[model samples]
Target: MVRVTGNEASMVLVMGVTGSGKSRFVNLLRGGSVEEGDGLMSVTQECQIVRVKIGSELAYVVDTPGFDDTTRSDADIFEEITTFLATQYASGLALKGITFLHRITDVRMQGSTLSTMTMFKELCGDHALKSVVLLTTFWDKLSDKSIGARRQQELRQEFWLDMTAKGSQVRRFDGSRDMAEALVMRLVDRPPVVLQIQRDIMQQGKRLEDTGVGRKIATRLDRSLEEKDKELEDLEKQISKASKRRSSRDLKQLEERLGRKLTERERIYASRQKLKASLGPEINAKVEKQQKSSPIMDKIQFFASILGMTVSVTTNIVLPLLGVAF
Candidate 1:
């Protein structure tokens, strides 16, 4: 386990839906214990950062909370994740790459799983696809190897077609430490790219809700609220019928369900409010302050590094504009 004092280390974000083996994958790299969720309930409620020595480079592997969390709404998960990414980006910490894990044993991709993938794409944007790795795990658990192979092909042909076409790599994780290290080393060796969400927050000065992923989340929340309202309405009618029939047990169950749904609705409302809150202004302020204090060359280098442009391009194009001879 390699430890670093500063936060300037290259970062790799690991993400997927619940039960996708994200934490386990991180543990493999760190060679230490990271709390793994039991069955499908998400144990990683927040981002857990682990430091590892990938060859000569010290990298931070961030295990993020999975969507479909039992205790939190999807909106809550989204806000928590985006806030971390925005803060890191503003602080000049660019991700080396992103690894998205999926369970090969899953018979088919559920709606929530598909939504998570779509949200991830929106979060990373097209420019950052070259720095992403799509990983399918749980191959060791598959009794029949052909089943896993078929699912992998399906993902390649249908779900992952766009990402692969855009320069993302798709690889099967064999649940080995050697494989984990190899994957992470591949990422840390590449040039760091700024994710679209990061650019939206820091450069565009856009509110979280105005970001592409944020807007997608808002749409999902609105749809969830609508569905919850319909559920509550149906429950109300059922409760009324049960009460009229003097069925205490049925009425009690209906009332209980209604109460639970109402609580869930409130959580959704809270997430919506969190989404509307503006995080861009504060980050932009920090950026402004940093730019003011730094020298011209330093600023140029800083921007060039985070913007994912090559040093040669920055030297040739950007320096020329400032009347600086190379």
Candidate 2:
């Protein structure tokens, strides 16, 4: 187990799209057995915190679910994350920095990738961007290093320009425990910062939907609902024509399309509902859930016992089972 001697340890948050190597990165750091997601599916559905010994200080490294999660809505993911951040901030635990992972092998940034980046920016805001690191992963998977280098430059110049200009860094995460620790140590000395979303909810007394990241997600959902509605309309027209013509094959295809569209619409509506619901009750319920089964409580209580701090389940942040020491 990592030893702590200070009033608080530095905390770092790792964020990225699903399959961007978040769990793998945390596992590398602590020699922990956090389950890594296959490149297509996400395994770290909730925030997973691990204790790591960086030089002499211990930092709590948190792994978060990405925006385009395979099984959960973005709204749900955002709410869960908000619970973690709000708890930590209210407990007086500011983060030293945040690391955003990305796959170096992706040829270009997709719409989903751009949207995730936008959310990250909004969550951090301008001032906190200085503490952000854009860590690119999967370099070893690239066949031609030159192509990857060019893509990296494109990210800094185009897609990630705003963040880079605002003091966010772009670095490559070579697949090694040493590199991961190095990334964490880079921000250990910088004064801890309260993220924009944390301030919005905790200090400014803003509702979840009123925050910057919240507004971005809401806008995206609105556009997606509109697009899906249009697609449903188009499918309805095609189905109508197919029915009038009595073409069995086309009618079957159109009907199947309509069914898929309806299912998607239902999911979109559900996500919207989650966004509209109150956050206080959800967070309180999550706290209750963690009280019964979360290993994070064990770790936090352990910290409290050693550090002489007052740690309680009410502010218990979600932590997955993690091995101790690096």
Candidate 3:
């Protein structure tokens, strides 16, 4: 059991079933390169910690062996995760939250997946309430709009509803490069206990020396904090400007735009109804006529009719195929 001796940062354990892209998720979390070897085939046999420094906050992204491993008993896996958490806590590490990653491409949520999640909550006690985020991964695989929409709906209906019911934060995440950056930013802004731990580490380091290793570490941390603060200030300014713009906008213009859009929609719907009514009988008659004909004979006759029509039209013209083959 590895003990966290000092002010350990918050740990975000990235966990899910085998082939659910846990390692890839961890790589994304750490802003590291996700290589070809990083697949669903168990890249991590044990718990591995990747530390990231984001604006003076230390975000420890923990990657554990895939849950729902066929070789490992369910009880064994659950105990392992619990033991890892216990060790972290014992070592003075703050539990930030657990990102229960599920692949978007999963046809259905497995029973084992749900069981592990429940076990995690049970192990964490009340601390799990605020720290859990059911992070759905592999969103890139859901490129088809219709399929992606259905998958998202299923997740919301099946998993997110229950998670929210249990007072857990549930969010869908695309494990793409661009989305990874956004996720990191979000983690920094809403840091778990790990950020506090990082601050403690930096503070302690700063007190040691004015130059050398301590000074370099302190300077880097300070710079990160300053950058984060600046970003927050800019975001606040943008929000304020947006709010002011919204307030200044004319209500009458909005109302008029809404009315116009409604009127246009109504007109289009009415025209479509009218057209459908007019074409209904003709279309039905044609369909019935075709349906009454024998399938093979109909196609034969259809081609025959076209050939005959062409010949008759040509016969009436000059040269007329030498007056019907002389």
Candidate 4:
């Protein structure tokens, strides 16, 4: 039981879509099988924690369900994550880093992949992004080796530009335990940070629906419903056209599917409403304050550390070489 003893252990959240190698990544770190699945089915259902020792200190890794999950609703996934984070925060656990697993083989970032990244950033907020590591996986699966470098370069420029500019580190995971540990160890040694969602739901006593990320989640749900409505409308028009051709079987099946889809959407919306239940007024003054102040402080601190390292290198190596030459 690698319990956190007064913030000594760093808790890291493993995030990404299905088959992005999140469970495999953490399994390597903890030397345990976390039930990795295949072929469009989600393996991990909810958030599970595996604790391992990094050096002399214990650290914990949380494996979360991915986006586009076949079995679970988006609302369910979001709620599960929010509750787990809030529980950890209440237990005095502080997150030191978050690892976003992405497949190097994914040549393009659009659709669900892009939306997943957006939700992740919204969850982390700008303040906590400094501790994020966008760990790209499946390096060993590159069939054409030359293309891997090109794809990674594209990801850096096109996909990860803004987050990288905000102090997030990017690294390659080569399907090795040592590689995963090396990536995580760099973060576990750093100072702990409370994510914006954690701070809002814990310190300020706000509901999950009231937090900035929570509100973002709600907005996402709204957009999803709107999209689903459009999809249903299109299906209805198609069904109407198919009726003229006596394609009753397929049209009826499609209508049934749309009806079920609409019901699911309504269920998710109702779940949010039930959870909301007037959990007090939305008071996130502290979260707003941090958002305004953190970026400037973080940039200054980042540059200062770099300058210090450059000075150290000059004194330790460059100056000695110059002296010998003189």
Candidate 5:
């Protein structure tokens, strides 16, 4: 419907592990109050766009749900983020850069963290690395500057070196508004390039399931299905044993958990199966229909034109009685 180009507001995507200070970082940038969560809870569960000023210009910063959110599955987060991004692109929102936050205090990169990063890479693709900012956050929590620096160096050498080698810039966030503003200012001037995912869907006419990310997610779903099947079998055996022992309380809890897991398993299978190998003419026709029906700018311009006519009417007729008060 909406043409996605560089004419709209500039958008910067902030993402990474949960509790890595992503919301706090965005709060400083936008100078707006976004809840900074505590403990194991992730603050941002949906992708939101906030407008922040960079000197004389205004830009948008997209605060995203964290990758390791305990409350949601990867599929849930992925679906939300993907839907938001696709909608934005469709509406002509031009993306400037993506800032990935990592906690400097974490001594080891946990598996969930790594899985999140892998998912991030798959979403962006190799070509989009040039627009990535590998930002290390929560630096103020570190007791020693050298420790942080050394850890940063180790990351460049061990994990992020490949990405940096490809054009991603690694920077340390001092958890200051100035630093956040500086990062936004630097990236907003760059030419907007369509992300690989955007290109795959829009230009190549590929469905979500055909992209590299869709394939990766499908693989995970398959493995998860296998695990769920095994768990289901084990739960059945346990339920049988509990039935013989007459433990009603334990049986009830186990049955409830079994029902939940079964529902989740079915959802995963359905999600995987619905992803088509390719987007055909039906999708194309729908897009075209949306484009025709959604003439938002034209409607606005019509109202604006009416306003212009009202001004003319005021000048010629109403002023005749007022007699040049100004």
Candidate 6:
């Protein structure tokens, strides 16, 4: 979840072992095309930083080489992550947090994966408190029970319990279209003020996010305003005619009453318009800003962008290269 705004920027790292579906998850989150690969096999030999937009914010999702690569030693992997973080921070990018992505299909958590997580935590220092553990690739296989329950049980027996006891947030995510909404809700701690307005509208049997009532109200209001204006114009004409005739004072009084009613209606319409103008964007901005600080949101945004870009790059460039060579 990379949200970039003119106000501030945050960077997140998506990390996992080879074949843990890091690239797939990234592409899914990003709404991008999927690439063909079995882990870290790619044209990209080193770590890469991909930029993505989330609402009014800019987010950078850094994808590092897989931690459990057979060719790369544990020390080398650790150094690679450390170097990336150091370079980013030195370049004045704010280091917000890391998402430790694990494949739900992968029943075994290797030692190298654990080591990678530990190294990230140590490198981040106090900021590690902001870290989120995202269990990715969850929808790979369906089961009556939770996938890899035995492995999850083992993790709970070992790491999960400890992390929970220490107040770390852990969430399970299956990369899908609804991922953004899910991530946004999880990350945004404060309710949007516009939600109150929506609630009010809902009580009147309407929903703000729903197109039906809002559109109906808008149409009706426009017609009503036009009709009222016409009525006011007619009343003025009647008043003028009555004054010229010098026969009926009652018609003049009726015209005055209609004039007052029209003024009141216009005032109410103006007030509603003012309320809509004031609350809509203000609430949206608040909701979006709060989302940027969310670990889950950050993870979703980063992975989504990376996955899309990776797939596009692979399809357009890598696949063509292979075709040319073969």
User: What's the true lDDT of residue 242 in model 1?
Assistant: 95
Q: Please state every model's RMSD to the true fold in angstroms.
A: 9.9, 7.6, 32.7, 12.1, 11.0, 25.0
Q: Which runs in model 3 stand beyond 4 Å of their true positions?
A: 1-8, 31-40, 124-127, 181-326
Please, what are the lDDT tens digits per residue for candidate 4 over residues 256-322?
Answer: 9888878877876775664463222222233234334543333212222222311111000111111
User: Which of 1 and 2 is ahead in TM-score?
Assistant: 1
Candidate 3 vs candidate 6, TM-score winner: 3
TM-score quality measure for candidate 5: 0.79
Ten contiguous residues minimizing lDDT sum, candidate 2: 311-320
Per-residue lDDT for 78-112 in model 2, tens only?
A: 98888777666644455899999999999888888
Which prediction has the highest TM-score against the true structure? 5
Model 1 lDDT vs. the true structure?
0.77
Which digits, one per residue and each the tens of the lDDT, describe model 6 over residues 1-326? 23443445455556666766656655644544334376444322356554555454445556666655666433344434433443343223455544566666665766756765554444433324444544545555647435566666666567666554544455555555355223432332222111112332322332232322233334545666677777777878877787788857767696768879788667646533532322233333444454555434343333333223231222110111111110
lDDT of 5 by residue, 1-326 (tens): 44433224577888989998888877876544466786548877777656665655556777789767877766667656665555445545568888999999989888988888887887887888888989998888877989999999998899888788878899888887767767776777676756777776666777767777777777888898999999999999999999999999999999998999899889888767755534334444544555676545432122222223111100001111121111
Candidate achieving the largest lDDT = 1
- In candidate 4, the residue pairs with backbone N, CA or C atoms under 3 Å apart (3 or more residues apart, or in different chains) clash, namely none
The residue-level lDDT of candidate 3 at 155 comes to 75
Regions of candidate 2 where Cα sits further than 4 Å from its true position: 1-7, 223-264, 277-326
Count clashing residue pairs per candidate.
Answer: 0, 0, 4, 0, 1, 17
In model 5, the worst 10-residue window by lDDT is 310-319
lDDT of model 6, residue 225: 69
Please give each candidate's TM-score. Answer: 0.78, 0.76, 0.50, 0.72, 0.79, 0.49
Query: Under the 3 Å rule for N, CA and C atoms, how many clashes does model 6 have?
Result: 17
Q: Which segments of model 4 are wrong by more than 4 Å?
A: 1-7, 223-262, 274-326
Return the lDDT, model 3, position 283: 28
lDDT of each: 0.77, 0.76, 0.48, 0.68, 0.70, 0.47
